[model samples]
Target: MVIVLDFGGQYNQLIARRVRECNVYCEVLPYTTSLDRIREIAPKGIIFTGGPASVYAPDAPSIDPGIFSLGIPVLGICYGCQLMTYLLGGTVSKAPVREYGRTEITVSDSSNLFKEVTTNTICWMSHTDYIEKPAAGFTVVASSDSCPIAAIENTERNLYGVQFHPEVVHTPEGTKMLHNFLYRVCNCNGDWVMSSFAEEAVANLKAKIGDKKVLCALSGGVDSSVAAVMISKAVGKQLTCIFVDHGLLRKNEGDEVEEIFTKQFDVNFVRVNAQQRFYDKLAGVCEPEQKRKIIGEEFIRVFEEEAKKIGTVDFLVQGTIYPDVIESGLGKSAVIKSHHNVGGLPDYVDFKEIIEPLRNLFKDEVRKVGLELGIPEKLVFRQPFPGPGLAIRIIGDVTPEKIAILQDADYIYREEIAKAGLDRSIGQYFAVLTNLRSVGVMGDERTYDYTIALRAVTTTDFMTAEFAELPWELLGRISNRIVNEVKHVNRICYDITGKPPATIEWE
Candidate 1:
């Protein structure tokens, strides 16, 4: 396996994704990890991720230089490139002008890393300090106008460094560079795939939950469904899936979820229709977090009741992924805004253990895993819906009427998104119902009703997202349909803010 030494770069995960795209297995570890610990993994190659900090910083992270002596192939990225230079007695000075965007790199030698890549290629550069001199016994194989030692290679030691990012999609030959590293230098076979991962995960899960009954909370999304299926395959009757329909699902979603679990999979599925219970709990809830908390608490109560009927559930299975846990900062005890399943768990609630089978997988990878599990493509490629569902879509105090109106608006939004042939292209697309209403004259009669805000975001992970750029004609059609057909919504608008400044959901 190739090991990625993470130096706190945002693209660290992208590096891992690129490695996986080459069909080679890779795992990420903190830069502070010791060389001895690295040796235990017996990695075929190592890739150093870029960081935000300068190598010369007083509090910057550093790795033991001894790891390079292990004779394993090493590839250094931007900040990693600077670290390689500093650790190997090379010079890295603060750049006279910082390089931040696209730059052209000229390759002097195309034998190893740049084998299949063009001699002159566009690359993504983000760094303040630049490598000024090559390390001892290292040759400068590539150079750019901004930096002389743009790329370096120690042929004898199989150590390579690139000052620009090759993992990002913007770098055209990034995949080729990774393929060469995994295959040519590291001699690693491209054998890793979703099926193999699923097989290994099943074995590990069975061993971990031996003789223990596990209850999986199915949210009807691809993540939970895939998790439930995997757990069922591992534990069979010992695994029970409890689905709580919070009356926030889209049209026919509850029935669809129940049908898939019971008829198709032959899994023990407990369908609890607690719509009224959830609605009752969220009677006067206006705030998004408050509504999420109420829904989560009600869901737990329903699951708890069902679990009590069964008695003594040893493990609680959640489809929690790394992004969710990382963004929530579960370990740091960051003030978690009730995430229904994850953040909503009460402090007083007790469970013997929690199992997250898909914890290490990303959203797209989750879909791939679902496909490998023989799940229908519809579920695998379904557009992402929020955990709180249309509850968050209803801006004001949630009522059955509000839910109905929002559901209709949301359905229309999805239908139009698909009609525009942008369903698969976009990641998550939904509509939010705002409390404020605008006056409009329909058939010469003045009417005032709720305003529905349309939000569509394209993202690899929900942690960071950018609003989708829908065509003007398509947007107009959606707005017209919602206003003309769906009652209670007098106006429609799109959310343009990104994730940092504003979340995908208006609430």
Candidate 2:
């Protein structure tokens, strides 16, 4: 196990993901964690993450000096490196020429930290302070043009530090460096696999909800489906899944959900076709927040009614994953259209207890769990669909026709992505049905129609995302298909904006 002490780096979770990629379990903790608590986990290695603060500041965060004496293999990154140097009687001074982007680093002694690193390597540097002097036991391993102590290590103490961020993909050898740390330094067995996770999760669920009826709100997405399947395996007939189709689904999605849940998984599912109820509740609702609130309240009411009809349901099972819990209530607004059901949940709900089987997993890890649980690949790796369904996809009004148009456009976008064989590579790909309509020439005649924007992104976490680089030929093919096949869509465009200024979804 690898333990990362988070000093408030934005990429702290990225480090954890890299460690997990090497089949090693890792967790991130605040820098304020005590040495005694650290020892309790008995981690094989420790990583210190970068932060915004300079180590020379008067009120900067400082860890206990005793942490180094624990004899665990330690790797410090960026600001973490400066903190280690300053704590060990070294000097760190603010430099006038701060580096914030790419820098050239030359290997000094070919230390263990840079075992396979080339003589000249490109590194991602983001630091304003420099390590002016090294501690007594540490030696300079690598150096950049601007910073003298680019990397340092004390093999005897099993400590290593790098001034650049190796966890980021911008650094070419980032993944390789992380692999070296996990395999060479920590000597991990590399045995954490999906099958083991599934087994453990099943055991935990059975133990937690022994003889208790669990009611899961199935949203027909991969996460909810996988959670429902796992719960069924835990307590055979004691689980009941309620799938609410709130009049906001894509074309024929409610029937698909009913057919799949009842026919494939064979779980005891209650199909609540509350389309008219949802439409009636959402009459004259133009604001996004109001729509979300109305849908949320309706969902809870539907679930409560289903739970009562099914007799005593003790546990309210949810498919709330890690990112959903992190984004909400942290004062962080949704950067993308968050996987719904988890995002826009109502406050008013009465249930015995809540059970979230996939709470600790990420989006990718949830797919792995689904694969382990024998879910079909098509359903497991399907592009994420929002819980609000086509309601969010329709830019302005929530009408059946608007949803139909958006669904047709979205279907074309997804079909093209899969046809290009980029579905697995791309993190998320969706179509945004813009509210504005423009005039166009069709068949040498002037006509007015709606425009559809295609968006695809590649990201490990949806928090920060960049537009995916789709091949030009594939883009052209998709645009042609959307305009020719989908009615009322005369123009097609691609979304080139990242997470900050533009979200993945228009709504």
Name the best candidate (by lDDT). 1
Computed on alpha carbons, the lDDT of every model, listed in order, comes to 0.83, 0.82
Cα distance off (Å), candidate 1, residue 439: 2.0
For 51-170, candidate 1 gives per-residue lDDT tens digits of 888888887778889988999999999988889889999988899998888889898645588887889988888889998877898988888887788888888999999998999867
**Candidate 2 TM-score over all chains jointly:** 0.91
Which pairs in model 1 have colliding backbones?
A: none
**Which residue pairs overlap in candidate 2's backbone?**
none
| TM-score for all models, in order of appearance | 0.92, 0.91
Model 1 residue 488 lDDT?
78
Error of 2 at 458 (Å): 3.6
